[model samples]
Target: MNPDEDIKGMFDCCFTIFYQLKGFGEEILEDKLVHKLIYLLPESWESKKIAIIEAKDLKKLKLDELIGSLLTYELMSKRLIREKGKKIKEQGIDINIIALKSSKKHQEDSSEEGSEDEEMVYLFKNFARFMKSEKERSKH
Candidate 1:
């Protein structure tokens, strides 16, 4: 699927959950959700993620602000990836394989530095899994 589709799906899923929680009178803490959302973002969003993490009064952060930042980063990343794909195509190389290779290389290179994004992604995935399971359970 294209990056735009993937990003829309992510946004929808997160926003749905947030809406449900709020509608149910649940106390949705800004800081915690913001942290999870940042972690849930792709590595290409490192700069935005870092900025959010470093922001003061994180507890007071608004959901709209987080969503806007994510949307901006998603669009920027999609454009960059599209441009890179075009370049790779002009060189007569398979973009998928190149992407896979680059992804592996990135992981390897960042492994030594203990990438916070990696850890955050892991946590975010686990949390998403949990949310999915909980949602399924609630359906029963």
Candidate 2:
């Protein structure tokens, strides 16, 4: 949950602690563990956390799905930051006056490119559904 640390590392550290607890005879239910993971997420992840909470029933949710959504969000955000930085460099817009660099053509071009990455979308929706279906079939 440290803003300075990456989400992937933070989650991994939590899992390590969780395993240590298990080794020490402290049993944690999967649902509780998943809930705790979401609860401990930083403010920056509020939107994603809310989406997961509202979109799915926690009892049926797998830990991997939760992490996948979060990691996908993380990657998408990083990609956006990189793309925005590249755009700024291409435009030669002084960071000091970023507000003044608003141009209609620039806005239109950005809009046309779409706000969300298609690959990330596929990972969250299509891929997740496919995985869930496969898991259910395997259970039978």
Candidate 3:
């Protein structure tokens, strides 16, 4: 299999495990989750895999922390791939400096929009409770 395929497989495995475990009412033990995550990691992450395995307090690590690390790694890997692709495309061509700036601006805008959407969702979930409490206070 090619390197891209291997990376995709690793991402799929990690996301699947996260989705399965994240919904449970009880917390998954750190040791078991860590072992599973380490085992699921591809050889490309050799340094990280080694570091996680050799950590003195692997058992004490939280599941959320592990998941966050894995997610960040995945995002970084994807960004690197995108940058590499951009570099390849730029070769043997007159790169448009303005286009590059616009592309970066677009990425930043999209990220900000994502944060705003998350904030809206949080408010939507809590707004009803807040209104109910306000009504009770007004009656009392």
Top of the candidates by TM-score: 2
Candidates 2 and 3: which is better by lDDT? 2
Give all candidates' CA lDDT scores: 0.77, 0.88, 0.73
TM-score of each: 0.48, 0.70, 0.44
lDDT of residue 17 for candidate 3: 70
lDDT of 2 by residue, 14-85 (tens): 999999999999999999998999899999888998999999898888999988888899999999999999
Pairwise TM-score winner, candidates 2 and 3: 2
Residue 88 in model 3: shift from native, Å?
1.7
- Name the 10 consecutive residues with the lowest summed lDDT in model 1: 1-10
Better of 1 and 3 by TM-score: 1
Whole-structure CA lDDT of model 1? 0.77
In model 3, the clashing pairs are none
Candidate 3 Cα errors over 4 Å, as ranges = 1-28, 93-140
- RMSD in Å for all candidates: 15.8, 10.6, 14.6
- After superposition, the stretches of candidate 2 with alpha carbons farther than 4 Å from their true spots are 100-140
